[model samples]
Target: MEAYRLLIADVYELAGLSRRTSEEMARAVGQTAARWHVLSVLSDAPRTVPSAARRLGLAPQSVQRVIGDLVDSGHVEAVDNPDHARSPLMRLTGQGRRALDELFARSEDDRAAVVDRAGVTAGELAAAREVLRKLAGALRTSVPHP
Candidate 1:
C-alpha cells in the first residue's frame, strides 16, 4: 500500500512536470499545450468534440472551445458526421499536420532523454504502463457514493 501511494505521488509529479515541458514546447511552435493535445488526439482520426474530450480527459465545453480555435486558425476543420447531425467530427487539416509533425520533431530529444535518465528497461516501462492501465480501469468502474 505504501509503495502504491508513493507511485501515485510520483505519477502526479511526473504529470505536472510533463505538462510544463509540453507547454514550453507548444509555445515554441506558437501553440498552447491544450491545443497540442487536442491536435494529437485528432491526428489519430476524426472524432466528435465530445468523443475527443472523453479521450483527452477534458471537459466537452473546453474541447469545443479548442476545436473552435483550431478551426479559426485553419489547423482543423469540422466535417459532417453521418451518425450525428448536430455533432460534427473534427479532422486535422494540412496545417495542423505540419504543426503536429513539427512538435514531434521538437520533442524527440526530450523523449530520448527520459529513457536515458530513467535507465529503466523497456520491459519495465511496459509493465509499469500495464499496471497503470489496470488501475485506471478499476478506478473508472468504481461505484460512486452520494
Candidate 2:
C-alpha cells in the first residue's frame, strides 16, 4: 500500500541520481550524457537511428540529434544501411570506444564506492533488480506509447 507508493517515488529519485552519475561520467570523457548514451548503444554494433532509439527507449529525433553531435566530435560515424537507404547505420569510432571504456572504468569505481557506503549486498541488489525488471516489464506492456 504505502510501501508501493514509496517505491514509485524512490524509483524516480533513483532515476535522477542515475542520470546525474551518468552525466558526470560522460563529462569526464568530454561528452554529454546524451552523446555518450548514443555512442554506447552503437558500441554493440552498427544500428540505424530508429533501431538504436528503440533499443535505448529514446525518441528517434533526440537520438538523431545526439548522433549529429557525436559525429561532429568524431565519436561516431554513419555507414551505409543495407536495409534502409535514408536511415544510415551508426557505429562507434575508436575515439568513442576509448571514451566509453574510460567512462565504464570510472563508473565501476564509483559504483563500488557507493555499494560499499550503502552496504548493499550483491544478492540484495540482484533481487532488487529482478523486482524492478518485473515492474518495468509490466509497465512497458501496459503503458501507451512506452
Candidate 3:
C-alpha cells in the first residue's frame, strides 16, 4: 500500500540519519558507533560476543572486530564464562563506563533538541516505537532469511 511504502521510506531515512548522528557523538569521545554500541551493552551486564551480537542484531564477526578494538584500548576486558570456555563474557571496564557515560551526556542534549525541534510529545515517540517494534516482528516472521 502507498501508506506502508511511505512509512518504510521514512524509517529507512531515519535509521540512516540516526546512525550518522550516533557516529558523530561517538567520535567526540574518540570512539566509533560500533565500539560504543558494544560498550553500551556491556555496561549493563557482561555478555559473550555472540550474545551481544544477537542482542544488537549484528553479525558476530563485526562485533568481534569491535570487541577486539575495545580490548586493545583497555576499555573492555574478557572475563571467564562458565557456560562456554572459548567464548568469554565481555565486561565494560571503568574506562569504558566513563567513555559510555560521556557519550550519553553528549547525546542527551541532541536528543532533547530533536524532540523540541520536531515538536513531538513523549507519547508520540512511544507510539512510534511500538509501531516499529511490531513491524520488525512481522517482518522477521514473514520475510525469508537468506
Q: Write one digit per residue (lDDT tens) for candidate 3, span 103-129.
A: 999999999999999999999999999
- After TM-score superposition, the amount by which residue 132's alpha carbon in candidate 1 deviates from its true location, in angstroms, is 2.2
Q: Supply candidate 2's per-residue lDDT for 19.
A: 82
Cα RMSD to the true fold for all candidates: 2.5, 2.6, 2.5
**What lDDT would candidate 1 get against the real structure?**
0.92
TM for candidate 1 is 0.87
Best by lDDT: 1
lDDT of 2 at 112: 92
State the number of backbone clashes in model 2: 0
Model 1: per-residue lDDT, tens digit, 50-80?
Answer: 8998777778999999999999999999999
| Candidate rank order under lDDT | 1, 3, 2
What do the candidate models score in CA lDDT, each in turn? Answer: 0.92, 0.86, 0.90
Candidate 3 lDDT score relative to the true structure: 0.90
Candidate 2 positional error at 126, Å: 2.6
Query: Highest TM-score among the candidates is held by which one?
Result: 1
The residue pairs that clash in candidate 1, if any, are: none
